[model samples]
Structure formats: structure tokens, C-alpha cells
Target chain A: MRRAKFKAAAVAFIASATLASATLASAPAQAEIASGAVLANTCFSCHGTDGKSAGDMPTIAGKSEDFITRKLKAFKSGELEATIMNRIAKGFTDEEIAALAKFFSRR
Target chain B: MTELTRRGFNKGLGATTALGALSLSGIAPATAAGKAQVVVVGGGFGGATAAKYIKRFDPKIGVTLVEPSKRFVTCPFSNTVIGGLNTIDYITHGYDALKGLGVEVVHDSAAAVDGAKKQVRLAGGGSIGFDRCIVAPGVDFRWEAIEGLDAGTAARIPHAWKAGAQTLLLRKQLEAMADGGVFVISPPVNPFRCPPGPGERISLVASYFKTAKPRSKIIVLDPKEKFSKEGLFKEGWAALYPGMIEYRNLAEDGLVRRVDPASRTLYTDFGEETGDVVNFIPAQKAGKIAQVSGLADKTEWCPIHPRSFESTLQPGVHVIGDASIAAPMPKSAFTASTQAKVCAEAVVNLLRGAAPGAPKFINVCYSLVGENYGISVAMVYGYRDGRIVKIEGSGGLSPSGATPEFRRKEADYTRGWYESISRDIWG
Candidate 1:
């Protein structure tokens, strides 16, 4: 029952994110999506289809922009330690990093 | 193709078996004229974070990351893998992220450091000079602590404690055990990576086998009598994976004295404990590279100015993650990642001839106690009077005696955090 709810909620989140992105909120951060998508390619590999893991992966599909940005900044900046994430995140551009936060938060 | 080029260069240099402190000797004598050369060792948390930041913070600061492997697998959340929550491939990553960021990625082993001369001897018979350096080499196993255990034995009975293939290796072995097989976990002594990691791991592993291999059971032997999140784990184990888990504290000889893989048995000081599959997370210290760099003092870890994370024995270098003696924080990935950021800011300030003062550190570790039931501990800290001290308003543990609802929420938060943190570090 609990797992079912989680799956439903996750599906709802992805659907909402997809729906919402089409309207294209012109938040300055959202504008950097193309570049952020490129940088996010490294992440999308483990994080899975559009930051939504098949329930096994974490959902970066919809989070606060700065929150995602700060964390990536943390990894890139070394404020956090995740073996793969830290190594991979550290290689992003300042603009790319910002764009990633924006991309995932909006997704 | 870069791997082939590197192989050609090393063989051309007639290098045989690269060993010593990890270094970068491929630096081409600073022909770039006035650019600052920054060489980072270790491709794990600290080194990778520093290399990327140096390039972005000052792209002119030529950053060369000298690591033995082109790809690195993380140890954080690897418990999920050990527990069958995920796989190593999903958790593994490569240097393409860093390379894309315009950081020079050098796939070489650091042989030795000439800190005074600001140079690193490469494993491939060359010397790479640097203006400053960062060493985040993870850790190494202390093979001789147990009576009959060493690196060789670990291959037979993995300490999958460090993630990567070792984690999967142990998991595969566990999953293949007989229905009623005894799966034993030997937790390491104090000052090891991710203190809460083992208990979280055992619980998650037990969850998988409960349905798949109902008759299987687990036995945990530890060097310490008590542990962090003790109540929560015991409570969850009893209610969830009951009769499938047992714990023995080693103050009463809980330490495994010897092991014979052929016999599939482990002998603790208290008595003999045998299992179809055994997981041993042995005593640990900074990996060989950090040790060779003369960075680690007593405790076999680096001593650094908590505020800056700069090595006490060496200037122009900083150490973070499990290799450094960072108290007021557990040796977890979050702490390392946090320490990495603090170190990054400080290193940037130092490079720019600015000031690095009283930097704050934060850590929050979440462990999945059972399916969708997670617990955590969090704290915020600052370097005070030459020590890292926790800030009052910042952190706390998962609420005790909370609703199942609360626990489940923590699971969601943990996942969200992983997403948040992954994007922070890699995105």
C-alpha cells in the first residue's frame, strides 16, 4: 500500500513537471535549460529518465531551484561528498550548474 | 583513446608498477607562462570537487586531476547497493563531467610529492610541477588487524564497505547463500567511514531476503558495545526483519580474531561464529596516496585547519573527506562533501590572496532502516578556536518514537536529498 502511494505520487510529480514546463515560466533560471540539459546528461545517467528513477532513483524532477543549485554547488564546491556525484558534479560550469538547478527544479 | 595515449606515454617512459604517493608528473614544465598550476590528487569526493572549482573559480588556474582510474564509484548510499536497493552501475560515474568542464584530467598515479619544490613525481617516470595541490585520496584497509585476514582474504570475503564492485561482490554472495544460510556482518571499530552505514546496510539487506530467502538470517559482531541510532535500528529490526538479525558487541571479544574461508567460519574472541557469507569492514585509514604524501599524522588521517582544511604538515595543500581528521562530524559522504565545499572556498581564497575565515560546515546522513522507513542525523558546524564546532540552530536526528508516517517521510526526504545532493555535486 505504501509503495503504491509512493509510485503514484512519483508518477504525478513527473506528469505535473512535464505539464508545467510546457507553459514555460520565464524565470531567469529556467532560460538556461539547454546548457543545463547538456551538463545534466552526466547526472541523467544515474538519476535516470528525467531525474525520476523507476522508484529506485531519487526524483530531481521537481525541487526548489536554489536547493538543487546549492547541492550541485556543494558537490562542485566540495561542500558535499557523494562518490559519483561529487566527481561528476564538480566538472560543471558555473552557468551549467545554475542551469541544472533550474532545469531539475522546473522538471 | 586518451587511455591508449596515456598507456603509450607511461610505457614509453618505461614505468613499471606505479607506486608511492599518488602524483602528477605529466605537467609539461609550465610552458603556459603565467598561469597558476593546480594539481589535484584523488578522483573521489575532495579531489574532484577541488579540481572543478579551481577551473570555474579561475579558469586561468590550470587544474590537473591526477587519479589512478578514469572512472570512480562512490561509497555513499552504496549501502543501497549492498542492501539490494540499487546496482553499482547506477552509482558509478566517470571523469567526462570534469573533462567537459575544461579541467585537465590526468590518468596517472602520484608517485611522490616534492611539496617544498611544489612538484609531483608521476608513476610514468616524469615530474609534474604545481603551484598548489589538493589530496582527497579516500582510504585504505588495515589488513593485519585480524589474525588471518589481509587484502588477499578480502577478495575471498569482501569488506564491500567501500562500495564499487566489492559491494556488489558481497551482495551477490549473500543472495546466493542457502535459504537458511547465516549472513554475518562484522562492523569496523571507531573512526571509520560512515559510522551508521553498516546497521543501515544490514537492515536493508535483510528486507530483500525476507521475501526472497525467508529462511536466511544475519549475525552482526562489532568492536563497540553501543552504536549511533541504536534504538531505532533495534526497534525496526524486531518489528520488521525479526528472527533474521542478531547483534554481538565486541567489548566482550566482539572482534573477529580469525577467519577461514574454506571452512566458511569466523571466530570472535567471545566464541566461534560461522556463516555461509561474511561481510567484514575492517579497520581503515587514509589510502596509500595520502599516506605517501606525508599528509597523515597520528590516527593515520590528515590534520588540517578545520576552517580551511589545509594540511598541517604541508602548505599549498588541503585534505578533506575520510582522509582528514574532521570531528564534530561523522565520516560520511555528506560531511566529506560539506568539507570539500569549505575547502574549496578556502582554497579559492588562498589562491586569490584573500582571507578564509570561520567557514561553516554542515552534515545530514539518512539511512533506510527498512523499506520506506528511514532515519537520519543532521548538524551544522563552524570552526571555532581552532576546532570544528557544531552550530546550535542547525541539526538534529530523526525524531524518536514518531509515527510510521514520519519514518516514511524521512524515506522520501532521503531520496529527495540524494537527488538534491547528486545534482549539487554532479549536475
Candidate 2:
């Protein structure tokens, strides 16, 4: 069991290093689109981009990632009452929700 | 489901690697070093959002927004202005935010496009070149479709579709109306901007009558059999403004063949109807600039590739907003902004020689049925088989028997949505 856990950690480390290198490699060529920003942009139609809201809509920028994740999951599951967020949240996959949470949280 | 294992996660990354490799080969080299010129026309929701997003995606791409007007009045919440719930200034915005974002704001109309030369001619005798051009001129009324309802007559029987002086005119007419007066709203056929717009206007007018002119009646003459959020609008009308509002479908005395603006009478196939105030929303086509520039094809609107929103008829130019043929997705400010982002990404990817990613579009239209009562319809769209198709099991209408509290919350959401979207475009 200890050997297997060590192997898994090595594989994870290698994978992350490869991704980081690949991102750096593509940065100069401008071949990689900002996937998180592009995905988060869709919300700009109803929520300002980078989560800076203008009116009654609360800003999501700088919020805890866990808080956004919990609120989005509640919206997705229809547990929390919403006007349009429920329907919108239902459209995102779990992967997309995490990506969006990470994107907005960083802002 | 359990969390993805390391192997599974690595496999997903491997797929992304393949996609990136493909993108590297697919994109062509951009024209200039360190600065790519992206020109956007019409400074509305689509153009403004496209300009903002393109700059956000890559600061190196210099964006120039060409718009004749300095201030943009949104159509989303203009109905509330007509209903006396909000003021026009509340829906109006300026382009200062976009300018502060390093976008070159050109206060001039685009007269024509030299597509081959990759340049746009200004109406007031100037020319600007572009590496990529995005046109989002919104919609223009087809005045010839209705007899005696040209621009001059429209001043008398206001359409209030463009959300400025027309909106104020309609409000003034409503205010001048008698207590038991009749208010007539003639809605054009499908494929127009904001499908639920007429219905929402009717609700707001009814709300105003309930308080100001209780005996007043509203008549909606629709050219279609059904409308967006039909059931919800009907239910709210019945519950809130009982016996005060009447909806006539095309099959039932709804089609207005002609109008005599001098008499304030609308002649239909069934009979003649007069009103104290008339709103004649005429048939619509792509904005005049799209047609004159050869972007619009045989269809009244411009045809575009569903994925890139680039005009299929005109290369090197992208068309968005109500002017593009984006059916299944209604012609709305929200859809325009959404399409703008997708188009912006495509433009950037193509400039940088990267493959454009798959496109997903979402539309949520909220309609206020009465004071503190609203309903909505939402859908998700995916590009497949060379066309945009609705995603199954995603998005639907508001519940049929929702509580008043739910509807009131929706109303609040409507206001919030307007604030959010307006700021996204102009703030």
C-alpha cells in the first residue's frame, strides 16, 4: 500500500509539471485560449465578468471557493431559491462548476 | 460518483494536449507584431461586449469601437420606462468604461465596408483599416411591410422598440389617455427582436392602468398564433388584470392589414379598431449597414457560421446580435452579448493560429407580467452538424404553478439581471 501511494504521488507530480511546462510553452505562441475566462465570460451577460457586479447582483470576486461551490451546487440542485441562477446553474457540469468557482475566486 | 482518479485526470489532460496540438497548427499568424487591430461596429451589447472581451483575452489586440451615438440605451428594461416604473436614464449607459479599458472609441457611423481591402468607411468621410471586423448593428424596421406606417407616421403611432424617444412618446400618450381609453399594441410576426417584449409591455401597461386608469383596456394584436412564455403571460394577465387585457392571435382578428394614422385606426381583416394610443411595431430586418455592406444575403438578416459567427457571405467579417441569423437563440441583448464572447474568442484564436473551441450558447429571457410578478424561459445551445441545436434536458420555462413569492423573486432577478448586463456592456 505504501509503494502504491508513492507511485500515485509521483505520477501526480509528473502530470502537474508537464501541464505547467506545456502552458509555458504555449504562452509565447498565444496558442492557448484562456479557457476559464472564456467559460466565466458567459456569466457576464447577467453577472459582470470577473464577478464584479454593478447593481443588486452581488460580486463573486474574492469569495471563498468553497462558498461559491456550495452556493452553485445548491442552485444546481434546486435546493436554494433563485430567479434565473437555478436554470443557469443546472446547465453547468461538475467540472465546469469547479472551473468557474476557481476562476471567480481568484479574481 | 467518486472523485476522478489520478490516471483518469491525466487522461483528461492528455485529451487537452491533443486539442492544444491541433490548435497550434490550425491558427494563422497575426498581421502585426505586438498589436492586432480589431474593429467592432455598432457599440451595442454585442459590439461593446466583443470589444471588451477581445481586449481582456489579449491586451496586445488593439480594439476600436465605431458607434455614432455616445450613449447606449438598452432595450431590456425599456418596457418599465414606458410603464412608469423606471426612467429612461435608468436604462441608458455611456461608453466611458470601454474607453478606459484602452478601446479606441470612434463616434462615427460605418458607412460601408471594403471587405477585400479590410477597411471600414466612415459615414463622415474617413476610413479605418482592420485585421478583423465585427458588425453588430442590431435591427432596423421594415417600414414598407405595413401601409401608412413609415418613419413619419411612426412618430405619431410610436413603436417604442428602440427604447429612446419612442419610449417617451408612448408614455406620454398613455399619460394623456382618458380613464376608459383603449390602448392598442400591434406586434409583428416571429423572428423579431425580443419575442417576449410585446407581452411584457402589455403587462406593464396593464399594471399602470390598474393604478392610474383602472377602467382602461389594453388590446394586443399579435401576428402569431402563440408567443414566448404564452401560458405564463396569460395566467398573470388573468390573475392580475382580469377583464382589462385582451390578446388576439392572428387567426382571431389579430392581423393588421393597414393603418390610418391620422384617424388612429387600425384596419384588420376582421374589422376596424381604433385606439387612444397605438404602438405599431413593424417587421424587422438587419440594420441598414449590414445590408449595404453586402453582409446580409438573400435573407433579410445576415447568415453566419454558427461556431465562429463569421459571416458566411462575407469573409474576414463577423456578424452578431439581432442582425445575424441565430435562430433557436432569440434576438436579444443577452444572446448578443453571449455571441460577442464566442466571436471574440474565435477572432483571437484565428489571429493567433489556434483552433477555435467548441461553442455553447445560453439564453434566459425574463418577462414581468405585473408588478412584482415575473416569469422566464431559458435554454442552452450547442453547435453541432453545422448548426446550432438546443441541448436536451437543459433549461426550461418557469414552473407552471409557481407561488407568488417565486414570481416576485423573479421580478427582483429581472432588475438584477438588467443591472448586471448593462454594466457588463458599458460599465
Candidate number with greatest DockQ = 2
Query: What is candidate 2's fraction of native contacts?
Result: 0.43
Tens digits of per-residue lDDT, candidate 2, A74-101, equal 9989899776677778777665666678
lDDT of 1 by residue, B308-350 (tens): 6778787667788888888877887777766765666555544
Best TM-score among the predictions, by candidate number: 2
What would the per-residue lDDT of candidate 2 be over residues B1-427, giving only the tens digit for each residue? 2123322432432344334334543433453344678899999889999999898888778899999987888888899999999999998899899989999999999998766677899998989987779999999999988988898997899999897889899999999999999999999887899999999999999999999999999888888899989999989998999999888998898999999999899999978889999999999999999999999987789998776787877667899999999888999888999999989987887566444555677788888987699899998776656677787667889988889998998887788788888888787
RMSD over all Cα atoms, model 2: 5.9
Where is model 2 chain B poorest over a 10-residue stretch in terms of lDDT? B1-10
Candidate 1 chain B: worst-modelled 10 consecutive residues by lDDT: B13-22
Of the candidates shown, which would achieve the greatest lDDT relative to the real structure?
A: 2
Docking class of 1: incorrect
- The collision pairs in model 2 are B27-B353, B27-B354, B28-B353
TM-score for chain B of all predictions: 0.89, 0.93
